[model samples]
Target: MASWSEAVEAAVRRHVAAAGSPFTRQALIDAELDAIVADVGSAGATPHQTLSRELQHLRDMGLLEFFAPGVYRWAGSLDEPMRAGTSKGVFVVGSHSIYQDEPERFYRFGPQWLPNASRIAGNWIIYQEPRRAGPRGYYAVAKVERIVPDPATEGMYLAVIEPGSYLELGRDVAFQFDGKAVERGLLNPDGRLNNGRAVQSIRTISDEDFNRIVGLGLIEDEDLLPRVDDPMPARVQEEHIPWEGPVDRATMLVSRTVRDRQFRKRVLDVYDCRCALTGMKLINGGGRAEAQAAHIKSVAAGGPDRVTNGIALSGTVHWMFDRGLISLSDEGAILLSRKINDIEGVSKLIYPNGRARLPGGVSRPDARYLEWHRRECFHA
Candidate 1:
């Protein structure tokens, strides 16, 4: 039989897995802890205290984490579970493996050693090998057909790609994936990937990097495009390309130029192109885009370009939000920090009820990132 602490830990893990998000003490009490209340109190801690201790135990054991004092986030689905402070959909080291059954397809196991591969089986389109191996590559982008696990193996996940889905760089030059930059591509400054030899095969790439990598040009053939059904990989003329060179404006615009547009489109579409804080959906003349995509975590701080990191805003509200004049709460409440001394100006622009509009589907801002804005970026 499991000890009381282990039982508590299991209950919390189940709660997190079921909720599909973080969980809190209240949630635990209401959902799985009610029956065990007396048992918990017998251990000298109240239900709340027992739960807290169990959560701490989990933290120590690297099972789950405290997003806040009461909240815990768990991604118990990936084959290699993402670590704390890392973003979702990041690659798992040592997860990518060659398919013994079919050479055309590759395996990417993740979130855990024996993870439920079905969580991310569908709805993903592309997968890119992060490292640039040998002389003839940077990344090989592939289209995911489905994910499967070896029934005999625990957490053995595979992101199976269509044959010929990988786009290759035939040229000799390779660039590494920075958090969001490819400065010289030799290796990232932050060291997330060392010389493109990150141990994992390939994890799900986030939307921001997906868009960026899709636009990356070859060193010799700058416009090489790959077809998934083609067995012959697209190859540019192999050339001796050095790590550092004078990049043209077109080459440098790949990530930001393409991704920023997608970010703005997603943000504005979710909010109907209205400013979430002020409800201003301004249209100048033609059907040109007027709403801007503003990052809750600014680009300088390494925020991904996914819709969750952005909000649709009018010009003035965007300016104020970026400068820390305003922030959104974890509960979607619009918060003007203590720095706003001009009450009249702020009040005229803000929503009377003070709630930032939530997106309809999955575009809801991560409370973790929202809390980050409140702590690091908000004026208060």
Candidate 2:
């Protein structure tokens, strides 16, 4: 068994390796620090306390430094996240050079920037006018399709941003927002954007905003876009509605989008981003969940778009559930159909006790939903 420090280090390494951002304290806990603690001995305190102590210990050894309140950066870090070939976050760009407003395409910023540079793509734009300008916070989010030399100016790098939701800065900068960053507002008390230096060359947005905006197709996902009353957008343009293909199809599409967003968040929150049955928390390089939210009952059979109506599952289990090849008992035990056999190594994925771990949260696997699955959906 590894030592306690070694175990924590291993977990931290796993987190850093898998994540596009720096490892965070909560991330370490989510990465199974408790199991790491258990491997050595009983924790003298709660897992959080123990992990805190260990992380501080690592800090004292100069292996890491606190990047934010709960975020930690590994020592000698090389801005690994920025070099990921593509990044999704807000960036501050000055207005003077190559920023076309009419047919907004290519833009440039920070040829003189010492710390920040070009990443892969998918960068959001938050246009910052010179200090105390009216109608501040105008944004034209974009995707960097190609990086080329600035045609208008030779010294700067030009970013060709894809067409996205664009609104001018006539006036009105106060934002009504939520989550951690939103709670405090995007601008610091002195009217500068948070998460940057005094001059503010580039600013990384909160993860909440980054994920939502990027997921919504760089501002095109109008239905899922942040509901902001921008005074700058043309009134008729804002009022215009895109034509829906057909009523039933449109209904299905809207339901699907809502369900996809809401169900995934709720179910994943319950299991802490792990499969309820297998305890697998597969994540991509971006540290985003690879798990799927599955309906206990088929949507075609009247399954509701609800947390209680769903479960967080891995891809394979999701497929199996849809086919009635696997299901859940009324008591929340995992019930795999006999169709799964050792010949396929499918049995190995099953829990030894043939039970699923019930996640602790507001909404749970509703017994009614489970019964519906067992009756109509399950092959058994």
Candidate 3:
């Protein structure tokens, strides 16, 4: 009887030498084991049982991970799972395994000895006309053809490509898929999957591809791809408020950019969705009209890009407040900048001139940034 280590090494070498194109476990039993055992003078003429036992022992030692039943691969040595933050998020480490049974589903199996595989399954994104009804959802399953990151979204994450999404092959031609496009029988069809019923599958175009398409005049800015956090400012009446002192154009530009999408949501969440300027509450209509994230110290002047440095303001008040035309005192009083009083034709703008609403149970703005804005940006 050969030593366990020697037997395992011999088995691995034999498995490799056969050079099967689509390597399957049965191939090992059919060719390599019989020849190797005959040469090794092993007592057992048939080495399939011995090889199976040895492979199981190797799994116990953590050298390999079983992605699916009877499927194995090298376990990454140094990778370990890490906690994301104080939030209930976790980061996992695993390998990208291409399933041979179902090609559409891509799976990532963790390195733990469990009965079932723990993995992130591919989901289908269905596309249909706006009011059209049917099975409108994405189904999660194990099998993936391609994975790429979406740059337009805030957090960096990968999206698995689903079949049937439009693909442009040449300058003026496009191809669409109806069936499992990639190689079939690559993944288990009945395995765990995520079905995205409401999410629509739009064809993914890479940034580079988009630039090329734009250069060719295939699409325009209005038809540009929708980002994950694009902000559409609801239209409101413009207020022409008089300023008592000089207005700062640079400061106003900086402030406007800060109110853009990236910093808006966090600021709104920090402020509990109430307008700091008017304390206006829109409990109905999904709270869309009342509150918005307003930058305390404008993005142009090096203010931090986060909720800690933002204030929630109503749509009407945010415009008047941002143009260096208004501000808030440390005592939380409304301070209409002198620019407001000095400028001609500015008195018509509706200004929240008295007690300003402040966010509940939140820390006040940093004095340094606020002072900088007041000294450099405030019209007064």
In order, candidate lDDTs are: 0.52, 0.53, 0.40
User: What's the C-alpha lDDT at position 78 in model 2?
Assistant: 31
Between candidates 1 and 3, the TM-score winner? 1
Candidate 1 residue lDDT tens string, 1-380: 12356446545644654565677778877887743432222334466776677778777877776788877776344333222211112222212444332212545443232222232343233233343343222323333456566564553556665443333222212334434344222123443334232332332334454444445533322221222232433331234558884343223323343344445555666788788888877675545445667878766665655567778887778778888888888888888767788877888787888787778554688676688888897887
lDDT of 2 at 147: 54
- My TM-score estimates for the predictions, one after another, are 0.40, 0.35, 0.31
Count of residue pairs whose backbone atoms collide, per candidate: 19, 2, 47
- Per-candidate RMSD, Å: 22.1, 25.1, 19.0
For candidate 2, the lDDT comes to 0.53
Angstrom error of the Cα, residue 194, model 2: value is 34
Give the number of the best model, judged by TM-score.
1
The candidate, 2 or 3, that scores higher on TM-score is 2
TM-score of 2: 0.35
Please provide, for model 2 over 292-346, each residue's C-alpha lDDT reduced to its tens digit, 9 standing for 90 to 100: 6777866666565456677888877888888888889878887767776552466
